[model samples]
Target: MNKIKQGIEKLWAGPWVPPEHGKMPYFWLLSLAYMGWKYAYVAPGALELAMLVLTLALFVPLYLASFRARGWQVHACMLAGCLFGAAWVRWNPGAATFFIFACAMAAGITKMKHAMLAIAAVIALALLASLQASGNMRFLFLMPILTAGLPVGVGAVMDARLRRSRQELLRKQEEVEHMATIAERERISRDLHDLLGHSLSLIALKAELARKLVHRDADACAREVGDIEASARQALAEVRAAVTGYREKGLASALASARASLAAAEVALEENVERIPLAPAAENVLALALREAVTNVVRHAGARRCSVSLELEHGVAVLRIADDGQARSAADIRHGNGLCGMRERVQSVGGKLALRARAGLELELRVPAAVSSGMNP
Candidate 1:
């Protein structure tokens, strides 16, 4: 059974020869003609035996010669050979001359204008051959030209269709590669935001608190120093997580970090809360923005109260962390590395980050809610 199956597979997978395979069919037809003529006309004579051997011998070399030529040239030569064989089969029949010329025109004329000229020449030759031979001139002149013209037109149309298909396939391949590049850039941006934002925010809060207590109380100053040490550890862990592409930071964790940092800095912390699920990417960027805003308040704004708000509005999770601190001028904020890092994080996730001051310092972060909903609650 296995052997039978293997044989069937081999039959289906056999080599594919094409329309060009039919180019040598004329040689086989010539051999068959010779055999038929021998039996009908020669009557067991030496001349008949000699003709049979000659016809069989002609078949092998002519077929092999067609294979050795280049593709278009081989088809052209085969058409010419078919016409010659037809003429030899019945010299009295002027139609044979037309057949030979029809083959020559098919092989020789690649352009449409040239093909039409070649067809006219074939018809002219058949007419001249019939005038010379005393055969039925009218029928001999017309039939062969009509038969050969059909296949040549069909082959040309097939060639044009194949070329157009190849061009369309190449265009689609380029579009797919362009889309892949965009997706890769977005993934990289999300990872960077998650890694650095929270750690930096906590650091800024501890630094600000430590600065304020430097001259006031030694015990409180030591506590601020301890907070800085904890923030540094958290930053290191976040960096490793980002590098490894871990999507573990949830929206709640980020909000909690923002509140804790503000409280540690002795700033009044407030939350306008909502339950917002987040994709790993949105969670990372929003968390980073929150951290940066809180840090900026402690380091630059000398104000006291800070507010962190998270809400779902119009299919987007909006996070705004504002501090009632001494607002820095726009020029000062732009020049700072902390704010620049925050912007980079937001941009990575296809979201927006802005720092504005109305009464105090306001840092607003917005990301698509679709991204947030993808995360674990």
Candidate 2:
């Protein structure tokens, strides 16, 4: 049973037919049924019937082979088909079916101009053969000529469109791959900055304080050194977690870190956070947004007081980070990579980020509650 199935598959596809092209070459042979008129009415001799059968046996392989042929090979196939039609049209008017196949195959040529020219020449040969067979250009003899022309125009147009669509699909695939690479690179850069920026700042402040206390107070200096060591270890762990794709800094930890970071910078911290249920993904996005916002406040806002707020409003998690620092212009905010990264992170999980600047800067993030994973409550 397996051998029989394999045999059937091989015969249907064949070695000569390109896998990309369509099949059913045998079905097209039915077009030669019109040849029954000559066999039934004219009663040709055995010699003529044998010659027609020989021509058909040879033409079948050539027709099948044309599916995988290229360049000049295609031209050779077309010429062979036309020659067969021209040679036998006087004995069998139905031989024009070969011309239809020849002109249709010519449409596969790479160059449109060349393919059209080849199709026109094959059609002209077919018409000439018909004219010579009947000895005139009468309408009765001209009917088969129409078959040659129809496939030429229709085949060329359809083949051209298929080629264009394939090329367009390839171009879109390349564009999507390029965009994915860029997005991955941006993610690494943004995560690294969000993970390390505040930690490094706090480390710097501790180092400065330790230096000042080293001469006047030994115990305080040692405590500052210990804090520095702890922060360094935590930053290293966060870096490894990020690399291994385990970097989900929850909203609670982010708020605690913000308080410490702001205190190190002598900036007052205020909060109105709620214990709203959140999916791990939405919580991670919001946490990263808060850290990045607070880092920006410490480094650029130079404000005395900064506020962090989180609340569930109508099944939406709304987070706001505002500071009473100097305001920045819209152009400056747009140009900053930190702000741009925050916006991208917010929008990635179907969230929105908005900015308002009057006496200071305010960043707002809203993520739908529909994505709740029911685990981060």
List TM-scores for all candidates, in order. Answer: 0.48, 0.63
lDDT of 1 by residue, 330-357 (tens): 6545446566766776776788877786
Best by TM-score: 2
Query: How many steric overlaps are in each model, in order?
Result: 10, 0
When summed lDDT is taken over every stretch of 10 residues in candidate 2, the lowest stretch is 134-143
Worst 10 residues of 1 by lDDT: 89-98
The whole-model C-alpha lDDT of candidate 2 against the native structure comes to 0.78
Candidate 2 per-residue lDDT over residues 189-300, each given as its tens digit: 8878888987787788788888999999999999989989988997898777756656555777778778878887889988888778787778878888888898888888
